[model samples]
Target: MKTDNSNIDDLREVLHWIRNLVTGRLKIHFSQIDDYLVENIAFSEETTGLASFAITHQPTFIEFAVLALSYVPHIQPDFFNKIIAEYLPDGGDFPEFGCVKGTNHRGILPTGETAQFIIAGDDIGKRIAVQRLFSSEHWFAKEHVLWLEQVREGEPAMSGRMIMNPEIVELLTLGTVSKPSFSIDFPAEHIETEMDWDDLVLPETTFRQIQEIEQWIACNETLINDWGMKKRIKPGYRALFYGPPGTGKTLTAMLLGKQTGNEVFRIDLSRVISKYIGETEKNLARLFDKAENKNWILFFDEADALFGKRTDIRDAHDKYANQEVAYLLQRVENYNGLVILASNQRSNIDNAFSRRFQNIIPFPMPRPEERLSIWKKTIPQQLPLDMDLDIENIALRYELSGAAILNIIQYCSIQLLADTAPFLTAEMLDAAVRREYIKEGRIT
Candidate 1:
């Protein structure tokens, strides 16, 4: 199951042919070390057989390579020697100079960095190494080790190998691959924990949809599994959450992650959305690929920005906007992992693309009774409580959302604490109400 250079001669030959052909025209001189990479039969031929193994066992090949290469220095085996001889056959050892850039050895272009050498192992390694080559001002030995650590921790190879420049290492790494993404279908596994969904102060409708989302995910396991397999992915999910803000959309997302026992990655759209045409899609592709590999649930907090309706093609700008939507449509529909998009106005989303979402949960505003319940829950049992506090009357008077109720409760608690009194009072409640109304823009 574990393959070193010993069993990869076929891979070595493959790499040798690939490099010789590529180097002749491109003028990018690859040392035998680079040649050894192309020849690496272990991952090349075994990549198909190990497809399941690599994805399941080594979630991130770059990370795997990092760990693999870090140990290479310490590995007293012929594996590394054979690989090294393919490049530096002239009896010169790669200078283990404490630094990566200032080295006497030219194992890779412009510098003798370990990241470059690491790429010979897998596509994941190629991507990570490419990233380190261009991104850093001066490649340090520590950066190489960091890449190794990321791989060992099971992080995605894309993040590891994609150099900052997107030029030298772009071919095998970040640039969009020509391969059409595979669509695997797996049965949805809907496993429920003993989560007291009632504890969260979200709307009943929203809560029900959250339950439905869980069920949808569970029921569609077949589709998910198939999607992952066809796509050569380990596991992935994608869903959209659109409703009015302050209705606990974000909180509900966190709870969903808690229920699923997966770490939620709330995407910063500003960071992911690029101004350059087609770049946004590329970035998204990279992110989803990485997330798929790492098994992280991606949460787009402001879903509208990225998933907005396509505008009329008034100008070149309009065309790109539509293109963005089209690109997102393809990505979201195919994503095999938990992908959540929260929007304040559902109408703002394109209907054509929106229909693809398996779970669409609406977060309606709370009714007066629900608001009353929220107030009671907001006032913690440990807090000084006035038993005579007419919560029903107060709830009717304020007509506050769950968020507003919490704000009021917090204000009352603060006021109660400031005073020597141990109990929340009517006056404190009144002040809190006024403050909440103002903060929530209810008066305006």
Candidate 2:
């Protein structure tokens, strides 16, 4: 096992910086956690902290020998003596690894350079602890550290790599030591954080499905990493939320993005479908490319527009429409992020694309119990209520979509604002409901 001197130096520096950050003696600015750290950390206009990166390295025979010699001397004498005398009488506790030869399988170092460090652990906890020790202050003595020490920008502080042995690849991690770097240019285009989930009330089953998506993100990080490494194959999660319009289909799509740290980009098929040959496919290509690069959730609200039935070649138009669906099939298969398609008419979507879905959740209309819950939740706390106003009766009679219910409530409140009584009467509530129904063309 042979350790690179520069890497060793980097490890030392990183340990020192970590101690500074934890102790408050040094200011540390982390771009990833800027929202929380901006208030405490300090940096000049020219200096910004390093971007942390991790890698795992397997020790060579020479590298392992050096680490044992270097770190062993620093361990507490009691711990060192107990193992060295008793364990090493024949060699050491299970014979400290890093003592294999590249060609000759004997000794602590394959090449026996005696400078490499061998970090071993029986479990993930110990491995992670070892990584964090170097990542923080335990490895660096306080006296050797200075105040206001900063991590250098663009310099990778951490590395996570797999240590390849015959049967397993043990994960190893390390860091570098460098002063912070400054950004040469500010981003010209910035994302607006104002995007929020819609105000549609959801059923318990629907809410649980959304939560499952979040859990999947946490549990499937490794799968995502693997997908990222694979080229050409667009890796995206497919979800089908089928329900009637105004039943919270699009709202759920936005909620998925808002909750999962992804941008939700709704695909407008009106803009995507074209009369020109190959134009529809070209539009889809562009849409997928941008969404993939930005890690956005490409949402197809009213999926029937693009994913509707594929017509036979009745004419050139019909042929192009079929081609458009074919193009979508290819692009979606390769997309490596979340692609959500919401349709009021799920039956309209072609079977060719339906098979690609991993999760197809039916977004049914709110049941009576669910609607009762929505009505209770949507009422404003501040709105004055007349004891005579029967909200339960209104909810039962209208059986409206959550959006419509909310709108009706708002309309009722406004209409009653000038009245002496703050509570809405049944007559007023009925009027509000009638107005909403007429607006939706449910009545002429």
Candidate 3:
């Protein structure tokens, strides 16, 4: 079944009311003319139910819109034509000079230069009109559509409609709602992890770190709304996940996002880093600007490449690199949400950068018992195992990371699948282990 988007229709209904009210005002003001402007209500009953909704939600909004739209000719003439063309179709005519009426003008049309001049010209009258209309509803406190500047295409321009901000417009027209609205677009893969908290295999201390962060996320609202304001500490949480590849850094990030119910974005450092001066900051600012207010986690994987220790200022490149690092650190510190930075080498990250993080959890190579558990979990227990198969012995003998063990299992499983009696063999397992070591140049 298709979902009915009532927000769109409710908005159109409100537009109809504004069109009605504005046209009614036009008819009264221009009553001396023989052919007074009128509106054609071509919209279906299902689409535009009545003017009751706008009166309840935004009574002064339409009145202000009428006043604001008068300036549309000055700022957005093309947009104004697009709006009025609906009532006064391309064939319809509204004369440039006195007393000429549109043949198809069903309602009062604000299409003439006179209407534009009158609306734009009356500075004092407009002020009094604003005060008269919104005496009860404070105009300054309201989120009026006339003020917000949105990008028309690639450049910034004001979208002259209420509740039709760029984000909502994208949501209505396109399926996806663009975040931040700073960069033309963002390049980040949204990852959904299949691994849960229970599937993770790491040291007890590291697991405790995960628990602490999880509890913090769960109590984040309480901390901010209840405790954080009292203490004056920032609400954002920053953590560093450092270890060798395949020791569960990425999986932990994925699981954290899944657990928190907040959307996670993994930054692409390649795109963010630029050779030109100030371009890097511009891109970073755009990303962070969009990220603000939304409770989203930003995962910076392979972050050592960007947040590494500052080099001696022997050259311009070195100076800029340090500046880039400084810029990133400042943004992270100011951001009011969770940021997880993962790196293979903790030493590569500057002490200044490292100090900002609340937790610096180490993901060491899985110990023998943990490796045994990882091995067991990688394959289903229901799969037949040979009498010689021993995950514990394999775990003890080979100093393989959690990732390496999975790779070895995959290698042996594929080879066994082609055999007459498919089952794990000690010889096959040993061969796979040796192959993995050789592949990594550890046993070459």
Candidate 4:
């Protein structure tokens, strides 16, 4: 990544401010710390890079200090150590500094207590006020900027390590935020496609329903905010896409995001659902928290695994399962952007959840004409076809989904390439169709 010069200069100024504050506090004591902060901290409307973020958010002096302090270890690992060493020349423990050693990094890492110490120092009332910066009400926590890490039970909340959001860190350093990789912490995979709306073949009714979703994405912000309907209307748009596996449900989601210039993420249910009680909710919470305010379309493929029919309270396990559904339903409803839940059948999802959706779209098996369109669009025009091979007849004869037709075409293309055949023959297409039928457990 190319480093921005403005970002480097801004960060350098922040480092200089931090050094002066630390050294001044050590010499003049905590009484004069506020003066140091007030004199040093400033914001500019025209600033670029990380300073631009500060300008947009307009963070308070102490809040900006905490944010910058949390970022210091990432850029300058030995920042606090050098400051502490200057004050404590003997190199002994400085408990008042409120820092801990990282497992791998051989430098002092700042924690919530460090922020409190820097901004509040010995003033108990000031320290109490500083704690609010880490609270849920703060924009930092609400926006997923930076937060105090959770510590073990019974420990002081201030003692927990400060963690800056990795995406925010990247944006500050590299001047662009990259897509997050799928991991245990983030169970959603970024999904996109190069295919356009023209490539999709669907029934007119289904296509019209999809257009409604597109309209919602286009005009939702205007409806909610600009039109002053936020108080009366719900925050997000929820939709259910029900169809068989080979239908175009997933592809439609990718196209929606593509057309809207928003990212689409498919939640991995295997990684999300946990056998242990409460673990499932925790996993989902992490996913939702990261996705909050991101304007992402979250696609829950095979959503029945998490949003299935809630059973009667037959046992403790059943009770917990129902609770998980309720929690998921709440999150989906509250999400500000689009939430699409896909299932093979709408009946698989809980009726309670279904009642909450703004739209329920059925992606029924494509008709013979639609299948024919898919067949014609998918095949390469340059590839020679046998004069006797009737694509229209094949489309009419076989009941296939768009995805199934693509699979058959892919198979035929590979065979033609491998054999260096002059033309794609009827026999080759028939063989590929047979393979698809066998895979689907249908008699051929």
Candidate 5:
């Protein structure tokens, strides 16, 4: 992974400044400290890596110092020790420096207090201002860039270790942030499809509504930012995609991202909705915090599990469940990008969420014509059908979803390979369709 030289230089300069500030404070060189406070760190204009990030955010000198401090441990493991060793050569504990040794790492890890000491020293007013950098209102926290970790119940907030978001660390170090994988911390999977819009067969009404969503993706920034509608309009677009299973709801969401050049993440509700009180919200917070500024499409599949209608307050569990719905509503409303909630039925969603949606699109089971279109598009050109096979009659007779059609095709293809058959006979097709009908508990 080749990093930009400019980013390396910028990081080196910030580290050097940290060293100078620490040395000046320890040596009681008040004039040097004053001079350093007045001088701003110069950064390169080259817009590729970490230098570009700094330039874009335009952080204050103190903020930049803290950002660099949080990142130093990851890159230069012994940075703080090297600085502290110069003064206290015997290496006694320096409480004012405010650092803790990691359990696995022998090197010193800077805490929020360490940031205060380097930037503010014994100055009480400056130290108070340093606390703002870690506050929730700060862009650092809002953007999931950097923050102080939570400490024990009784411990001071500043005593918590200074932590930078792992994605930010990767972005600065590798010049790109990799797409996050599905895990407990992030209960979402990156979803995409190679299939084009033309490949997706839908009823005319549903197709038009989908196109409207595409229009929003294309023109939303212009409406909010360029047209001066920021104050009047919500920053985000929320849509509800409700339909029966295997009816192209997920495919439409993926296509929206594909057509509009946005990344789509499907939240795994199974992992998100926890049995314990407040755990669900915590999981959601972790998800939303990471997704805050990134213009990614968030698709909540089978969302009724998390966004179901609030039940009447019968007990503590019921009350908390309602509260969770309320919290999710707030988060969804505030998200600046596209949020799509998918459900088997629209009525399953809470009225609170339903009212907030910009569009409520229904993906009904495909009509005969649409099913025929799907069939024509789905069958491989290389796999010839038997002369007696009537695909039109099959499409008209079976009330199947686009997904079910694909499944039937897959089953027939496998059977063809198994029997060393060159063509798909009506018998093979009928057997595959019957298998699908049986799976759905429908009479064959």
Candidate 6:
């Protein structure tokens, strides 16, 4: 059966058939298999063809079977178990994959050995599947595949645990492949927010930078294909969004993700730092490994965790911390996708990290015009505004960040709703602003 471009079921059918084909090897001939399966392999029931994404670009059923077998335990581990099942009484044949001599366990890469096996029938039907697969472009490089395969074998390298990219994991298990992007793992217990571009309220310079970011994202694929570039050209697509808290650095990141059709993963350094040495690097490695090959944007909030001035070697901790920073530099430089670092203060970022970034757009607090926009957009409608509520006057009265303006608007909406007020008066808004000031610790 040929499958559609992404014929998941057809893909499964090919693998299952291959599974049975390999299993039949236990017996001297394919005829020994169940009649139902035997007949299916015999020209099958009007084979349906599918277009597969195999490296060879061949969509034949045999090509799909080859791909299914090559990925090994990385995909359909259960199926591999069945294909390699030991129906034979045992003559030193591994029960896991029933190959007597040459068999690939499908780790990061093949063991650089041919996985030769007999394909049923007579002695002349010997074949080497690994030899063919090694000649193709695996989903991951052999080294990376080997690393993962080793890690799975319970002998993870000192580099700590790395994992298959999420997209790969989903493809193997769920039969679905997603566009490349980053999303937070709920188990990680990190709070991040995403918003549309329209939702962001920022000063003109900041908005211009966001537009530039959008343009950069649009040109990303062209930069690779047209520029003869595997990595980015000089002035890489990295950015530093520095601003006071609530000036929309985080919001801009979400907007960028939405605009670019990529998943943006926000990492909070405050939550990521660990007291244990090497744990931080392990976590960061895991993050990078997961993001690799996936079209994703890494948004690091409170990046001073990695960018802090290297302290004089006061102790071993200091030395390791510097190593962590160095590791970050290398990863970011090599990362083929986008990386955005946000900080409350530009001065807080280390010169070393900041120097490498291509864009360093500072977010300034909203001015009166932007504040007016924020008030108009955030304030809910149908709340009776006391004819006395003057939006222009409120915007003029307080020099507020977009965040602070939203907070006051929220308070005003709640107060009006709670009191069943017919109109939201200037007095109520003024009171809300007062509460915001107090909340900011401006007064007791």
Could you give candidate 3's per-residue lDDT for residues 204-302 as a string of tens digits?
A: 999999888888788878877866473677658999999998899888888988988877888888888889998888878867765766778888899
TM-score to native of every candidate shown: 0.59, 0.54, 0.71, 0.93, 0.94, 0.74
- Highest TM-score against the true fold, candidate: 5
Each candidate: RMSD: 12.6, 19.0, 8.2, 2.4, 2.2, 6.9
In model 6, what is the error at residue 352, expressed in angstroms? 0.9
Give per-residue CA lDDT, model 1, range 132-183, as digits (tens).
5333352323222222222336644332322222121221222222222222
**Candidate 4 on 132-187: residue-level lDDT in tens?**
88999999888889888889999998898999999888877766688889999899
Report how far off residue 88 is in candidate 5 (Å): 0.5
Question: What is the C-alpha lDDT profile of model 5 across 74-159, one tens digit per residue?
Answer: 88898878877877789676788889878898899989899888788888999998998888899998788988888999998998
Whole-model alpha-carbon lDDT for candidate 6? 0.61
Off by over 4 Å in 6: 1-8, 20-52, 55-67, 70-87, 90-139, 142-148, 151-166, 177-199, 229-236
Clashing pairs in 5: none
Give the residue spans of candidate 5 off by over 4 A: 1-6, 29-39
Error of 6 at 212 (Å): 1.4
Worst window of 10 by summed lDDT in candidate 1:
179-188
Once fitted onto the true fold, the runs of candidate 3 whose alpha carbons sit more than 4 angstroms away are: 1-5, 18-79, 82-121, 124-166, 172-184, 228-231
Q: Which lDDT tens digits does candidate 6 get at residues 1-444?
A: 233333455456656666665565545433565422322422222233222233224423433343444444455545444433345334343422322222353332222221233232232333333333333265334313322223344531211222334454344444456443333322122223555566677767778877887888788678778887755464247899888888888777776777777777777565456788887777777676666655678888888777777778889988998988888888887776788998889988888888888789999888888888888888777767766678998898797888888888777777777875757888777778888889888777
Q: Is candidate 1 or candidate 3 better by lDDT?
A: 3
Of models 2 and 6, which has the larger TM-score? 6
For residue 390, model 4's alpha carbon misses the true position, in angstroms, by: 2.2
